[model samples]
Target: MHKILVVSDTHRKDENFYRVIDIEKDVNLIIHCGDTEGSETQMQQLSTAPMRIVKGNNDFFSNLPDEQEFEVWPHRFFVTHGHRYLVNMGSTDIRREALVRGADVVIYGHTHKPVAAEIDGIYVFNPGSLSYPRQEGRKPSYLILTIDDEGELTYEIKYLELF
Candidate 1:
């Protein structure tokens, strides 16, 4: 079995950043959606499994890739910062990319709002913002994905309510 923790749009605050660190022991991967800004350096300080980080529009780094595609647990996955794809335009932008990559899952960040949906056999997840969330009636959150040995995929949304 393999597990992954996905988060995005952390901005700069570190509060609750380590809320899901426990997954490091059981998960095979950690994925950061984007908008990390200075939080990238902080993430580097963490002790956990491997991580894949994409670059968001607000990210100041010049070296990070705008998007990334990879496979895990025999499943193809696509991740993007979402600026170039212009996700704000519509879901079509991301849906097209997912189709092109032939990925089973697509993850992106922008708009600082959380959403998860599946279309045409492809699953798309956005963990919203951890440091600065734009959505109402909730705290910052992230996504936890579990892929069992049988290839079944299960996902849960984890949020921080730390006051």
Candidate 2:
């Protein structure tokens, strides 16, 4: 099995970011959905997991791609920061884009809220914000996506306090 850690909108917070990385040390992959607030520089010091990062509206000087695609065995994931797709209004545009990219899953973040759903047969998820969470309970959160050797998928959102 492979463990993937997904996090977003860290907004320059270091303590929580470090804690999360430390806790998920066994993860095989790490995806940061932007708004890192300058924390990307410290990523080399954070964890040993392989990482993928996309640019967010707040990541002004970053050279990271605005979006990208990742293929893990039988699944293809479209990853983005969600700002350009107008996620605040709704995910229709984003969903359409992911479909066009032949993605089986879509991961994005921008609203500082966690989301998990299957729209039009594609899984769409957001890991929420590690620095600012706007959802119910206002807990800092992230996502753990586990993919077994046979390609079975299981994903769960985890709050910082509970991590």
Task: Single out the weakest 10-residue window by summed lDDT for candidate 2.
Answer: 38-47
Q: Alpha-carbon error at 85 in model 2, in Å?
A: 0.8
**Model 2 C-alpha lDDT per residue in residues 23-134, reported as the tens digit of each score:** 8757999998988866786885566687899999999998889998989877899999999999998889999999999998899999999998888888899999988899
Candidate number achieving the greatest lDDT relative to the actual structure: 2
Please name the candidate that would achieve the greatest TM-score relative to the true structure: 2
Candidate 1 stretches with Cα past 4 Å from truth are 22-25
**Model 2 per-residue lDDT at 135:** 93
TM, every model: 0.91, 0.95
Least accurate stretch of 10 residues (summed lDDT) in model 1? 15-24
Per-residue lDDT of 1-87 in model 1, one digit per residue for the tens? 888888898777765667667533576788998787857766867837778989988987646778889987667899997878788
